[model samples]
Target: MSAGTAFLGSAGVLLIVTLIKLWALRKNPNDPILRAVCGTLFIGALLFVTAAPPHLAKINNWFGTPNIAAPIVYCILTAFDAVNIVLLIHWRGNDDAARTRRQTRLCLTAYVAVMAAIVLLFTMGDAPVERLRDLDTYYANTPFIREMIVLYLAAHTVAAVTMTVLCWRWSRQVPGSLRLGLLTIAAGSSSAFLYDLLKYTAIVARWSGANLDWLSTHAAFSLAGVSALLVAAGFLIPPLGQGASSRWGMFQQFQRLKPLWLEIQSEIPRTCPKPMSWWRSMDLRLMQRERDIHDAVLRLGPYFDASTGKRVYAEALAEHAERRRARGEADASVIAGAVIAKATARPAVSPEDRWMLTSTEDPEDLVRMSDALARSPRVQAIRRWAALVGSRG
Candidate 1:
């Protein structure tokens, strides 16, 4: 097969892989910006494959030109990239304050102004028909076409450089997995810009009456295909890799906590000089708190699906209820207090909590109890139990 065909096939395979991975990891409620970025990259890859390969065909067929489809697809891809950059800035600013929002808007406006300038420079002296025909011709012999190609290359070079710098600066604040992915994306985009430069140089050479067969139309098409695949892969790999890493981290964390939990359970009998019933009650309360904290941490990652969160929460609630049933009121209040402490210590509630309490089941009673304790008028009441349970933290 031809180089262009091979590149396109590879790109298509990678695109499928990227999409599947994204689908699996896109359930992260905290990652709306990431989801949008991945979706745009996927769409951009599709457009690149659809519109970029046609310039290679020697035959003048319907598919060969790609017609208006090429420019439209390019515009869409460009818009997505621009928006992705703006979103990155907003995200880096932590989505806070009116000033940050204004900064994001201003950055986006500047990007648009630059794009408009590039377009104007590229189309300055050319008639629409002539420009369109020139675009269709794989190897044009016109000075204006060469200049336009150079201008396009320069614009892309600037964009790639800016992205590289931005990604570098942003990497320090992000997690390792995300940092790796962003750096990969910057590198891939830089490669694509270099490919554009090569193509522009070839066009310039041809305009100067030089026959550089190595920089063929097919070569440029293949380069584009490779670049698109790399870009898509760069954008897609991070979320999937991060999710996997988080799951492994959770498992390790659980293993580390296991011994501590066992020790806490074993120590209760020795520490409590009261009756067996009292020791059992305290043990149950500690277990309930441990379970809540564990569930909350597990739900923090992207691995858990929508149902997983609810399932975990329900299971914890059931375990608490079972303890209550077995030990009666002696353990019930202590267990409830422990649950409140653990839940409040969590960074944020998962989406599952919102759905479970509001839509799925009647969790309002338990929620109200927790809220009441949190906002109690008497700090001494909780403090009394706090000393009894030795739950200072």
Candidate 2:
């Protein structure tokens, strides 16, 4: 029913969600950014729950005094925040060599110092109140305690704002998906900063003789927990979703292209004009290049559909074959007067045409050549090869 109890309940829910996200990230540590973000959130939520009223109450009941968990929780939360700061700095340095590791380390150290100062301020004041049970009486009598609360809230507000700004600036240089994730985290952290600001404003107003009630204070705490939850969710979801889609799409594309590659290999040999040995080297090279192209296509498979990729790949094969055939024809003309051509050329081979010079025995090689020629609209339209060499010839 009290403000602190409501915050504890929200913290408990957030703790569970953070744990679930952390488990997922543990299974997939390939994404370093996601892993770091989730790990920080998990630790942060745990620290918050440890410091919240219900858990603090259990600790207090055991020792009959104020629990040290509050300061200890603050320390753990500060450590995680420092870790996040260092992680971002490292990420920035990945793209910009100018960002030295020492600089990042110093930045993290500075953050820790500031957090320590804030915790010290909180500790020196009122014995960290757990719930709003005696808040009205406590505030009326302990004016200095209320001022310390305001100062503590103010310090956190400043730190949160500074962190949000740094994150926003750093996120700009990241890639698309990661940029979104970083910005989401920044936005969530900013919401927490805003909640801190509002809480401090409420404290200041109360000190100034305003009548802000328990409901308003609890509402601010609830919003802060929600903001932290949002940050955790942002860190966990986007990368996992994109990774799943990318893997599935790639698998489907490879499945489709496997058959098409086999078909092309089977068909090339049956349609070429030369003896299989004459063009064997060229044919094998073409097949090898096609295989390379297929592998590259597989690498890019996640980005495009299989049919489109196949069509593109087939076009490349046809072009390579055409170039090889042109080169072969030129070579044949040069060797037209050679004894080998005279001995091997069919009687039907004309002096002006040299298709027999390109004849091959490998049926598979000829079939592949035929498939390439058949697929080429330019070759089909010209009918140049057909006119130059008959099937019987």
Candidate 3:
């Protein structure tokens, strides 16, 4: 795809994601940080959309001035930058504190001043050529326009540098996906600084009669676009990405226990009230399977011989010598397998003695036990022990 198409596509996706998050945030309107973050992202995407070559003329027409879209875009972008820092401050847990409130107020005041300066400067400048895509480059030699470009770029550079430092420091304190997300944001913020530096240097070079238009008009904008995309992903990855990962983990765990669930369901079909359907939610199906497995185990409680567990534990201890030695989980699996085998044999047991098999209540132990029953030498040995013990009786 062309550069314009790629930039537009990325901006479109970011807009959609921001809108969706904004919609969700509606339920909790009291959250200032959430609103600020979402607003910053949405406005950043809007800046890209409005500043694209195809829409630049329409924007200028909407504002009723030659190349007037530049100031408006810069104003939104400046606000976006300020809001990013405000978000970082709030995320640092000083929300209700006086210091945080003061800092936030200062950021807003600075943003307003920047926006006012941009508007005032742009209003006084004369852009007779009315360039859409390269207004800053076109007016680089103009007096008021030069100052206006410098002002906006300076504001952008400060925000980028501040965010990079804040995110870099905060990244080390966070854990899991959030740490990665912060690192990603810091990298993107650093890119934004590079973008502003390039643009500012190119504009300054123009004052000396140098033709560095390609740096400001092409390279800088490309870096800005890349920074926007990476920053958007970083903001989204902590919550949405982690949520997706958790769902995938649940699905994987459910699939792993399918063999044991099916085996229990085959013997006691009534344990599950109905067959699984595609219409059921994955979590709901997993819940039902867990409930069915527990119920099946309970129905076989009378057959759960405690002596069988004792005998298997002894054999496993002899083989491993130490419970904390290698293959600790193998020892656990052997014990659980013995329980399964004894339950299958239907031996007599007192109600109090049946509690000995309660280890299956733990989800971890259940998975290990289920896996052993599905495919393990320990389970095979337990089955052989059951047969031999049954014959001797």
Candidate 4:
């Protein structure tokens, strides 16, 4: 691909990521990692746009100077390198906040010095002709221009190397999407380092009176877009994957509790939530359902009979059920018996019965009991017996 096409594609992807991070930033304004990531992506995008041949030429015409946009792009690129380093530092975590801040300040100072040198060299040198695509090779022998090109390239190389080493090591210590993301970043950063290595080779070839301009102009340019896209995906994966995982977990819990909730909801209408809006978040619906279930359990707790619950539990064990499953069946029969007794119980609830039900009020336990309520033949027999007892009353 042409340099313009590669650069433009990288810019577009970075811009989209930038907008997403910016929206996330509004919600978490004080998160250092988010802030640093946003800065890195935005600056990287800006660097690409400014370095595009057409945009660079327009910038030169606007300033009435030949190749003036080169220094401008170089400075922005240096800033991008600085922010990337800062982001990696932040990502390393705040185990020692003071040390992290010190490291970040030092990195910023060094990169800012590099940017100043790029500007100074541009002012001192003369590039009378515009060569947007081949500036590094064309100015390889020029005094100040050579130093300027070398400075930015050196700065970029250092950032890429540091990113690769740090991410590879960090990836091993982490698990799940974070691990995958860091490994991807390591790969992308190494590609960036290789791109610069080729650029260096091309410049040195020019110094030796040999032509290897394609190394800098073509090979490295192709790698640049792939590098940018990979790096963006690396940063994006963890958060997006974690968000998806959380939503799926909530959905599963909602489905698990749904049937049991519906079974009791009609009888205790006052404990139920009103018809919810279609647009409510899944978590909110889950919270509402959980609240209703807990409330219903407490309200129904008064009717529990300890003797009957113990007898049902003993019978379940005698039937050769696993202890865990037997416990669920016992709880299911107790709840079934309670449903019938709720209408007929006249005396105040004894503390023993309330505590018995309270001990089994765990949400996970409720889910198991609900499952048994729906599927257990043992619980179905108990339910029929309870119905007969209710009729006699």
Top candidate by lDDT:
4
Per-residue lDDT tens digits for candidate 1, residues 218-272, read: 4655566556566566665676787788666544443443432332242233333
Highest TM-score model number: 4
Better candidate number, 1 or 2, judged by TM-score: 2
For model 2, state the Cα shift of residue 324 in Å.
Answer: 14
lDDT of 2 at 85: 62
> Model 3 Cα displacement at 201 (Å)?
1.3
> Looking at candidate 2, what is the lDDT of residue 183?
82
Give the worst 10-residue stretch by lDDT in candidate 1.
Answer: 355-364
C-alpha RMSD in Å of predicted model 4 compared with the true structure: 3.1
Judged by whole-model lDDT over C-alpha atoms, candidate 3 comes out at 0.74
How many residue pairs clash in each candidate at the backbone level? 0, 24, 0, 0
Model 2 Cα lDDT, one tens digit per residue, 1-393: 854565566566656766776677778867655566666666666655665556667766766646345445545656655656655655555665555557666766775775666567555656655543324323533544455445445545655676688769868777666677678778877887877766655655666787554534465656656666656655655565567666655444433333334433423333343223433444454444345433432332222222322333345446666544443322222222121222334333333332232212333333333343435444342334333443335
Let me know the TM-score candidate 1 reaches against the reference structure. Answer: 0.51
Each candidate: what lDDT?
A: 0.49, 0.51, 0.74, 0.82
**Local lDDT at 204 for model 2:** 53
Could you tell me how far off, in angstroms, the CA of residue 47 lies in candidate 4 after the best superposition? Answer: 2.5
Rate residue 339 of model 4 by lDDT.
73
User: Which portions of model 1 miss their true places by more than 4 Å?
Assistant: 1-32, 52-69, 94-151, 169-175, 216-220, 257-393
